[model samples]
Target: MSLDTAALVTKLTEILGPSGIIAETAAMGAYLNEPRKRFHVPALAVVLPKSVAEVQALARFAFENGTPLIPQGGNTGLVGAQVPLKGNEVIVSLARLNGLREINADAGHMTVEAGMILEEAHKIAEAEGAMFPLWIASQGSARIGGVLSSNAGGVNVLAYGNARELCLGVEAVLADGRLYNGLNALKKDNTGYDLKDLLIGAEGTLGIITAATLKLFPLPAGYETAIVNLSSPEKALELFYAMRERAGTRLNAFELVPWIGLDIQTRHGMLDKDPTAGPSPWYALVEVSQPKGAEGGLLQAGLEAAFEANLIDNAVVAESLADRTRMWAFREQMSECQSREGASIKHDVSVPIAAIPRLIAEGSAAAQALVAGIRPVPFGHMGDGNIHFNFSPPVGADDKAFMAGAEPMHDAVYEVVLKLGGSVSAEHGIGQLKTELLKRVKDPVALEMMRAIKQALDPKDILNPGKMLS
Candidate 1:
């Protein structure tokens, strides 16, 4: 039998005291409003658990009473993973659990609670003369738990890796309030099943991550940054190959941005000044990290080789820190600038590195064929094959009507992505938004295994019910 709403709130209050519960619907705006503003279902109550013991107690209550629980972090996710899917679930906000547990900079690892903001983690690492290189646009608001749950891949993923690779181990709360203490800093352990890997990208469907041990690296001496002009994605791919061959692991980032991004940002007065080498069809923000006691001419030499090979036409290298920051500001502001234009249909998809040119070409053509004059703004981490394929509605078009026809647009783009052997959801995991899509595209046996794992870990389905597997 389902628990009564009032009774559920009362039990939650008992477990966390009155201050830990937010029963009023009006005051739960921040928890309900995700980054995308897509999901709007009301939750039973928003509970702020201050520590692991509180989380375990709440989990036990949910399991016993058959109450659905949603584990939420900073609420900065693009997909609807961090928000409510059904109306009866209670939101468990982990903000109060933010704390640094331990740090061993020389050992190249640190243990931190999941509620810690990603930027705060970076600060802690820097204080010890080490670095945690995972960086995203929302790092200031995105928490470590959500970051690992989604297996977030950011701009620096080319050099370091995603959340899964950056994480060494995790400590999570199971469905029956059992604590799974998997936290460790070992570099190599050929033990039994890799529970750490299983939980890192599970999207909170299996367990609620309470704490994690993250990998750290030596701090770089400095960085070389530049923006190179290209004719198309084809030429950009060629330039990427040459740079990879030359810089190898030092090539920290190679991001592709279309001319539309530059046009949109400058038109909206988002940039203080233009940070490009005049106008071009496309631009790439290339960066190389210089390690301690190392020279810093790697990027310049690579760009020079590209010019010699006829892969690039024009380029502007950053001469100072301010120049580099302005260059990055242009790339980081891509998503916001699109909103300023109008309603846009977005897809976070990835193809093989070599197939990116074809994916962009075919995907753009497919979307344009469906909707006349629709503006295509496809750009992202070219080095990693993830292109944030997006489309702004045609100028002077009705926003609501354009959004109403989003289904067909999504189909058109996804078809091209799958044909090129690409993923429908790349860095962004399938939350409530893509459960149906996952059903259609994912392999049958793989889905079976995933469901089996979910059932084994959370048979009662009280932890993040109706998510991922649907």
Candidate 2:
């Protein structure tokens, strides 16, 4: 009882009206094209649902018609989770669902519809004299549903945690079209099973997140920012410990960037000026939040102590807001600057904080051994133990040939990551890109439990088919 394309489009258009449904391939390009541009499978139709009722109706129709439905938010996901896999699936774009449901500035919470942009949420919070600390590079385009779906972690994860931690509760539409009304402002609940947590990082395989109640925080009075020059990752770690002891919860961010990153960025003319303290083997960008009624300079003080201890060779503390912004732009532009070089093999992995030095040192050596002259650029959240371990091909190397050898490069780095008791995919979840890798690396018992849950929840294997689980 498979419905033809015309019939399916007609039915969806009737349910959502003409403006809500798109069937032309050209019109559906935006939804199909993901951020990474790696996944290019075209979807059968793209459905723009304007309300929760519309989402439920679309879900119900797909459930009855056996049409695979891919839930898409801002299309900013790094992995291929928000794009089509089977090519015949329908994409349910949540862009029209944007709205600020409520905001309680004093209570430290805001309830927002899933389609709202992450940057918009920040502006709303800031207007109320509060802050939403999840600051990803994609925040300009990433939406709430996709952010919560991927459980995105950014620079401030060392302070506020990931999307899952910032969310108090969520409201999602189940595979069978039932709305799970779980949104709440409560700080404590003895509720059953914690279903909200289950759905937060499920990657839309279990349900479609419609809205979420997110926790807010008092706006910091100001920030103390610095870029310190270090000899190595080990020294960065030592400086990190000293800063943590000094600032404690106020230590907002600690990011590591290699010297080559600075070189590439400068060479590409991406930065108007250097954001670091001259040249060094490594640099750690640190920030400390100053609460209202508190003084700044905590970060500067910590850097001074690190310099006195000989943990850091040189440092530059941001003297103005522009300086701070430039420093952050340099750190956030790490991924974008790679494209200017050429083909890059990337892995988002994490080990324990104490083992970060070894992880970077050994991982770099292994990658160099595999591909001679491979520019190893291991950098990211050193405080959270996560690193965007990436390698740019040698100068004047073939981009296609270098990418073709990615599998061997991936294997080499992953083996080292495994030996260090780290995770293969840290912040980014196992999308279609890592389904097989997840199956192989994940524990057998854990895999069985996941499959059992998938079967119990989405019995028809229609919700985001061939994603997260095989």
Compute the lDDT of residue 66 as modeled in candidate 2.
91
Worst 10 residues of 1 by lDDT: 1-10
| lDDT, candidate 2, 193-218, per-residue tens | 88888998888999999999999999
Best by lDDT: 1
The models' CA-based lDDT, in order, is 0.93, 0.92
Q: 1-470 in candidate 1: lDDT tens per residue?
A: 26688888888999999999999999999999998889999988999999999999999998998988888888988878888887888998889999999999999999999899999999999999999999999999889999999999999989998999999999999999999999999989898999999998888888999999999999998999999999999999999999999999999999999999999998899999899999999999999999999988999999998999899999999999999999999999999999999898999999999999999999999989988999999999999999999999999999999999899999999999999999999999998989999999999999999999999989999888877889
RMSD of 1: 0.8
- Clashing residue pairs for model 1: none
TM-score of predicted structure 2: 0.99
lDDT of 1: 0.93
> Cα miss at 80, model 2 (Å)?
0.4
